[model samples]
Target: MTLTVRALRAGVPEDAEAFARTRRATIPYLVCTAEALAWEAAHAPAGQRLHRLLATGPDGTVAGCADTGLLAGSTAPGHGFLHTAVPPGQAGRGAGAALVAAGEAYLAGLGVRRVHSWVADEDGARRFAERLGYRRSRQARFLGLDLRHAPLPELPATLPAGVTLASVADFADDLRPLYEADVECAADEPGDVDVGATPYEVWLRLNWGRPDWDAGLSGVVLVDGRVAAYSVAQTDGVDRYWSGMTGTRRAFRGRGLATLAKLAALRRARAAGYVHAYTGNDATNAPMLAVNRRLGYRVVASEWRHLKAL
Candidate 1:
């Protein structure tokens, strides 16, 4: 069987669908759709140097996909990412190696000297990464809750004085405050590569414009009429829901506002007929992990960040 790896035809509907399908099949925990994939290819920031690669077999069917791009918001130079995936039954057909080679070549051409990738914490995946000169860096856990069966915490009958909960829709006219809050929270989040201040226009196109982002279901906590904490919600337009981000402002920490916002978001999600919820957190983030556990989330899978220096 002849195999080929090349840049994905972004404008082709079938290629976008195949890319999304491969991602979903390999990493079911993350949210991926044809529209999201196409949007990413079309709207990536200029500095990202994004490259979407696909591996196809003789039959013209996509066997694997890789998303390679420079981390535009990272403070360090030459930092980039390459996420490659091949469906379970399609492994060992040279698809993975082809995708990785293509991804690395593209990033190298863009002058990227360090590349990072997330590998499932499984024996095969770990061995494969190690064989390719990638070393383990950090660990992240994927958590899930059966929204239909798990007992979620009930929202307090009355919020703390000066604290009011509202949907993200409440900030439709202006999202500057929310953007500021997100930047603060993201700067402090634990990760191998620091995501520095994300610009407003970039945030608007990448986060806010996502097809799954549900403004109505997303919860925001206002303290004294100021945005203090928030939980961004995304739905598959079906039963699956995911938490894009849940953070509290620096001054508002330790007050349980993040928990309150997440609880409120989940309640709205459940009421909207979502039956499952998923989220991920760095293994070193103990505080967030505790919050998720308290909310009845269980570890579904773990992934390790692997880095290779070019």
Candidate 2:
């Protein structure tokens, strides 16, 4: 079938839905919705320069989608991200190649010095990136948990003194505390770009404000009345639950607060009828990987970071 490429323009509601559907098919481990995708594109910071594209087969179905932009969270400059995905059985066509070419050209025009992409370590995706002058770097894992059957850790019947479990809803009156903890946690995360500089406003818009974000299910750990750790929960409006982000402050690292936060969130999600849970982790993040393993998460898929000098 022949293919055509075009920008995923705003106000075009169908494109968002198509992209979301294709994303679900292309990467089942992650949770995404049309509303969340549209909101992010509309609310992203100006510097983000978020550009989205869609590839349509001759039959008028969405064969693939791509997005590229400058990394908004990094304090440094000239670093951007690229990702192009096509549905299963649609590879070998020109859709993926065309999308990457267009995405790279757009970012390069913006003077992006470097571009990064995550290529799934399967189905010749890594080879595809290599063909495009992208070199493999660090690897990451896509983890999944069978929440309906997996034996989750039992929560302690009694809480430690001055400690409490809370949710994003608990801090509806003030989100800065959560933002502050997130900033600190992101600083230590291993990645090509530093995310410690994510602005409060951008966090509010791109993260906390997403339509799929479950404020009531997302758990936070409190120590002496201060936010110490958090687990952001997102759902697909069905039974699937995904951990958007989970992190613990440096001072609270050894205390298992991050684990505590995730446990609380997962328990709440399972009780609420969610059957599956998914999360991603940098392969080098031993602490989080150990936590996931103890909690029965397995690496269902892996992807490697690929970089190119524009």
Scored by TM-score, the top model is 1
Q: Give lDDT per model, in order.
A: 0.91, 0.90
Q: Candidate 1 lDDT (Cα, whole model)?
A: 0.91
Clashing pairs in 1: none
lDDT (10s digit) by residue, model 2, range 63-135: 8999889987676788989899898878888889999989989998988889999999985897788898999
Minimal lDDT window, size 10, model 2: 193-202
- Residue 227 lDDT in model 1? 93
For residues 1-310, what per-residue lDDT tens digits would candidate 1 score against the true structure?
A: 5789988886899998899889989988888888878888888898998889889998888889999999888888999999999999888888988889889988999899999999999999999999999999999999999999998988899878999999999999999999999999998899887777877988988888878799999999999999999999988787888999999999999998899899999999999999989999999999899889989999999999999999
Candidate 2 similarity to native, TM-score: 0.97
Give the Cα RMSD of candidate 2.
1.3
> In model 2, which regions exceed 4 Å deviation?
none
TM-score of each: 0.97, 0.97
Q: What is the C-alpha RMSD of each candidate to the true structure, in Å?
A: 1.1, 1.3
